[model samples]
Target: MMKKSFATLTSVLLGSVVVLSACGSGDSSTGTPAPGGTPSGGASGEKVTVTLAGWTSSADEKELLQQTLNEFEKKNPNIKVNYEVIADQYMDVMKTRLIGGNGPDVFYLDAFEAPGLIQTGVVEPLDGYVTADFDTADFEQPLLAAFQTGGKTYGFPKDFSTLAMFYNKKDFKEAGITNPPKTWEELQDAAKKLTKSENGKVVRYGFGAAPEIARQMYMMKAFGGQVSDDKGSATFASPEALKGLQLVTDMHNVEKTSGEPKEVGAGWTGEMFGQGKASIVFEGNWAIPFLQTNYKDLEYGTAELPTVNGKKGTMAFPVAYVMNKDSKQKDASWKLLSYLTGKEGMKTWTSKGFALPTRKSVAAELGYDKDPLRAAIVAGASYATPWVDKATLPTIMNNFNNQFIEAYSGKAKLEDAMKKAQDTANKEISAAK
Candidate 1:
């Protein structure tokens, strides 16, 4: 799950097939000067291939990406972008290539991995390359800060997704629930009421949950728990953290109103909710297109995540366009990078709604805040925690998720599990450095 398969991907089976209509072609610069092309620089007038690397999600996703690149080529005739698709193990492949000095001029970097890569000095800091037209302030602040360390921006976020609660309208009506829960306690009560059983087996779970660190980080903070310290040490085993997480384990082992998607034979929350096996699930904007295409008949509504301790919070996952520090075409890469994240390019990329735009202006232009299904997701952006931490977050998260599953399943006491996970994570972190 390093590349996060949680992203909604289009396929014939899913019935969500995004069509990518072709854009302009890459004719030589001499053919016709691109309108407002990259500013003149070393070899801006000469044809140069600037390679880009990213992981393609599906045929539709890949095609849409290519369409965006085609648009870039049309605007910058002198710079030809060579797009490379890393099919699997994207981080491993990209890291290897970068260390070997064969990395793409520009490539995709998950915010999760940005901190570690930035620490290695392989990512080109974008602060010096920013143009007033690029508008760094236009980016959602938390997302923009995810790629910055020591006050230097190493990348510009390309797109982002935030967690929001999706509930089945039909289920709610049947259960006699008048409104979506606004607080964690209310959610629990509603979940118990919505859960249905048949012949001693669950017909539908009230909540479909993914017991992982990424989904529960906000919960950790709800009760004033520190997910990790400034030094990247695992500190989520404290009593305060457990207070927040008790709600999850209680929902699973005590209340029994919640279950993982796998328990219902569904691949993910979207599948669980789509098949009517779950009444509610917290998912990102990716779920909207998925439900529309595959479960057209499913009745659903979205809301901002239920408040925890009367506080609003959710998680935001963003991916960035990072240039290689060693790239021979730094200027060309910057030109393409700035344009792709620019207003016009962002609009084109996000118009189809595969992902949400990172730029505030682009988001306002797209009117997602006014979109019925997307409004909740957009609302969470204001208070959501960007899903990034010190470079050791990957390790700490792995340790917590691994042990916490045992607690969720009733095999281990949450108190003991959290302590074990924390100690193990800390030891590993200490060893790594």
Candidate 2:
């Protein structure tokens, strides 16, 4: 009876807005809201609708988000959610909408882009809306801390996935290797043995690499290099950063033992390994389900990323839910945000293991720490560097990847490429300012 009433109430309130589908876009506005955020109630007994937008994902993933949102509506009868999936170039579209004041009340923010977007003054700081029951401390400190600055909480991580070494058991057995690599030296040696060639034509690469900044940020620090200074300017050309990066790119150019997705006609490393094109790839928990669904017969094992420079390090990618600064329903949106990232909703969202819960309590309750496939990924949370940086990361990475590819392909010297990428990145950053 209560659920039915809630449904009817949402219908009546949104009748004029035309909700043709559960998670479809609609043109609706409630006037410009104040900076701190608007309070919930406008009328004595009126229902408030909160609009949300996120990037389009797989059918199953989309359905899971829907289920999570439905649960929120059930718990908070007075608040109704209007969700939509933005198509390709999600961040580009989202930024344009926010600038035009047509953005949703709440949306997903990748940690990589959080610093820049928060600087734009369009995202609401979440510190003021938090309630005592939200139990903010339960979330993994590193993951939760990514969205914070100057004692202000602007977003809360909904889930996180960390890098892990995914190796093919068949390839290892055939190569007479009983264990995955534990150190960089061991990994390079193992790669030589695992690599196969027929008639002087390489048949399988020993390792698959993404060669992007997101995947290689840790490499910069591995050799005492820094991607940027505190002010967010590009500083990745330092000798230490290049030294660390050259170590991995050398595997591709110097030894010809590594390649990325395009070189093998695979969409990603997961596909490259699943199709038996590569023996090892660094992937996250997301790859587990992909491999399971597409290549059920393939046997594989997971391990912590090979120690670099005698130090254990890996990258963690986490996304958070942030509220729009211009939304009139800020109070209502906070309710949904808190509920979605809160303990109960996270358990339901992560129950199927599509994503690992960000909350320590929820992760313990789910027992992913004991699951073989997920244990390595969970263990990385303690040390993994969040996939985030100063505001210029997007621009800096674009220029770096453009030239770094040439260097990785042996078309340019590693040091030359680093200098070129850094100069161009710094110039672009200056031009923008």
Scored by lDDT, model 1 comes in at 0.81
lDDT for each candidate structure: 0.81, 0.80
Worst 10 residues of 2 by lDDT: 1-10
Per-model RMSD to reference: 5.4, 7.5
TM-score of each prediction: 0.90, 0.89
- Candidate 1, residue 398: CA error in Å? 1.6
Per-residue lDDT of model 2, residues 1-433, tens digit only = 0001111212321222222232212223343343464555423445678888875345667688899999998887767888876655566767878888878888988788899999999888988777789998888888988899878999999988888899999999999999999998898888888888899877798998887777888888888888899877898889999877887898998888888777879867888889999999998887898789889999999999998888888888888999888777776787788888998889988888888999888998999987878888888887788888889998888888898888888899989998999999999988988
Candidate 1 ranges with C-alpha deviation above 4 Å: 1-44
Best-fitting candidate, scored by TM-score:
1
In the predicted model 1, the residue pairs found to clash are: none
lDDT of 2: 0.80
On residues 1-433, what C-alpha lDDT tens digit does candidate 1 reach at each position?
A: 1112333221221332222222122223332222223232325377877778776555777788788889989988877888876665677777877887777878888888888999988887777777677778888888888899997888888888898899999999999998999899999999999999999999899998888888888898988998898988999998889988999999989999999988999888878889999899998887887788888898889999999988998988888998887666667778888888888888888887778888888888999887888888877876888888899998888899899999999999999999999999999999999
Model 1 earns a TM-score of 0.90
